[model samples]
Target: MKANKLTTAIGEITTQGYTVIDDFLQPAQLKSVKALLARINGQFLGRNNFEGGKTERIYSLLAYDKVIQDIVEDARIMAICEAFLEDNFLLTTSQSICIHPGETPQPWHADDVFYSIPRPRPMVGLSTVIAIDDFSAENGGTEIVPGSHLWSDEKIGGDYREGDNERDSAFAERMASQSIALEMPAGACVVFAGNTLHRGGENKSNGPRQALSNQYCQPWARTIENFFLSVPRELVREMSPKLHSLLGYSVLSPFMGQVSGSHPLKTLEPGYLPPVSRLKPPC
Candidate 1:
């Protein structure tokens, strides 16, 4: 991203709460990612209405394939993230979302609601949704309320659950009236503030709609997905040092993410054992 173009993107997120990069992926990159996905047999259905019962999600995608790894470190995305989040930002969630036919609209909510910091604050995180297939208003294109990131808690949804999206019909109707479905081309990416109100639209098309999301948050924040347990250390060792940092192997300061008083990256060493494991049994 050029300096001027990058500024425009940041401006959009600052004011509109989101920005769409029309050509986030190259032709080759798009083809490569989809080819890999085709081999994965995407049949894992969501277990709840929030996760979309008819949708299939492949989580921990960075550990799934190389194409996904590349996508995570894409230069343009890193630029966007670096602008909103602090140094050593971590990947909060990474997965492919495939909304199958008949999937219903997800309740409107903000991605950073779990942080509980308060409303109308600067975004603690950033989110991305890269379309793997062309997204259409009729095919579950992601919908969002423009400029809602700056909305106060009281204005978000008064009749909803205290900290979650409300299932109340009136609440849904109010949000639906202001919702704008994102209809984008495959390979395009929509980047938004974590506090922005959004949700996956109902899939009314004959075929499924596929998109992958890679969300990032401030380094001090607890990641939504615990990558340490999900991705093998062996694989982490093979990844670049930058990825090592993104996966929480790097400390925030003197020792924030330290393992056994040692840098977390040390644990990725071959045959490494915890410092406590070397202690002799008490006599």
Candidate 2:
């Protein structure tokens, strides 16, 4: 990706709250990712709901999977993130969301609802949704409201009607609120800010609508999921240095004489530090 293209993508995301990049992943790479996911599914076959049975779907983290990790760190995608968030950024989460056909639509919400920690900065995080299959209105694609990320929380809540209503009324209201359906072909990726108002669409197709959502945030922001605890240190060591760093490593220290344990590995090599010196405490 050229610098100008990367700048344009970041600008669109910052201004509109969402931007779609067509063919973000190569066809061969997308095929390989699909194959790897199929293998994972096979290993857990017969397990109906993998996402803790929270909803009528299967969701799993593929952070330790090399293929998925590589996709998350793809140069094109990184360039876009770099343009918006600068060079240093941490990947908060990388998980697969599978919406099985006939499932009810997910309620409109933001991904940051689970994080109880307060953020010191605004617009410090964003999420990228990579389409594993052709996303169409009939296949349960995501819907979003343009520039809604800048709207007040109360106004966003007020957009929804109180009582149960027919699909026509609901759709009309959504349209009236400036909502847009995100229907894109496979291999494309939709990147949006954390504050973006969006929801999953109803899956009316016969098969599942699969997508890989990779979220990245500033080093200081608390992650929705504890990736370090879920993924082991050994797995982190096996990953590329860049991927390891992106997965919550190599962060800055807040306090003097204290080292933040953000990175999985402590020392780069043996004899790098004085033997008599004690390890610095985290701030």
Candidate 3:
């Protein structure tokens, strides 16, 4: 799609808290990204369980993967972030999530849980899930509760009971009320606000469902994954200057700098610093 169309799609995501962009990546580019993910998974197997008897296959530190980094930093994707977040933007996390067939459904939740630190200002972050393969209800596509981003913490907690039974009942009721099943085609993406209520569907089909989850937040927000720590300096140096900056490696020590007092440059072998810092010092 043209850049203008991508911008329009992002505008809708900003207004509605979620928007679907069809064919956001070209066929060749999509293939390359998929291959890169497969290679990473082959080299290093990473798995985690998000639901009972169901596991979420994930490959983090994707900023180290040249192909994956390129896709996230692509003009089309960055344009969306620029339109929504404007000046305060930083890549928080990027991962490829796969739900295998027969996995249990994931309960509805927001990504905000990571930001446990109380803040007076509104959340200024967005989550984008790019469908690498066709997402269908049969293959466990994502399900979302629209407009739930406005729910306060107390209100969100009040909707559920204390026990498992009550929780299940509440989820069922919510699903019955305002849930929308996402059936995104390959090369399309779903962008939602950080507080949007969403969950993974059960993958009933025989094949696995895969998608790339990329998050961008205001530079000040605490990130879920420590990007600078997880990614090696060797890889960071090879990355585009913009990607390096997005990974929080451009400046020496700003306010949010020294996440854990450790920098990627300190860990990796000599040769990671970019020729120039793309990001300005934090204000």
* Top-lDDT structure, candidate number: 1
* lDDT digits (tens) for residues 17-131 of candidate 3: 6888786778987998778767665332223235334444454546546667777787766877777664547788888877777876676676655666443224477888888
lDDT of 1 by residue, 71-164 (tens): 8988888999998888889999999999999998987878888887878799989999999999999999999999999998889755433433
Task: Name the candidate that leads on TM-score.
Answer: 1
Residue-wise C-alpha lDDT for candidate 2, range 148-208, written one tens digit per residue:
7676545554423321222445643663468677899888999988767676667789987
Off by over 4 Å in 1: 158-166
Report the lDDT of model 1 for residue 177.
89
Better of 1 and 2 by lDDT: 1
Any idea how many clashes model 3 has? 0
Q: Output the TM-score of candidate 3.
A: 0.79
Error of 1 at 276 (Å): 0.7
Query: What TM-score does candidate 2 get on C-alpha atoms?
Result: 0.78
TM-score of 1: 0.96
Q: Please identify model 2 stretches exceeding 4 Å from their true place.
A: 42-60, 114-121, 158-177, 253-264, 267-283
lDDT of 3: 0.68
Q: What's the lDDT of the predicted structure labeled candidate 1?
A: 0.88
Candidate 3 all-Cα RMSD: 6.6
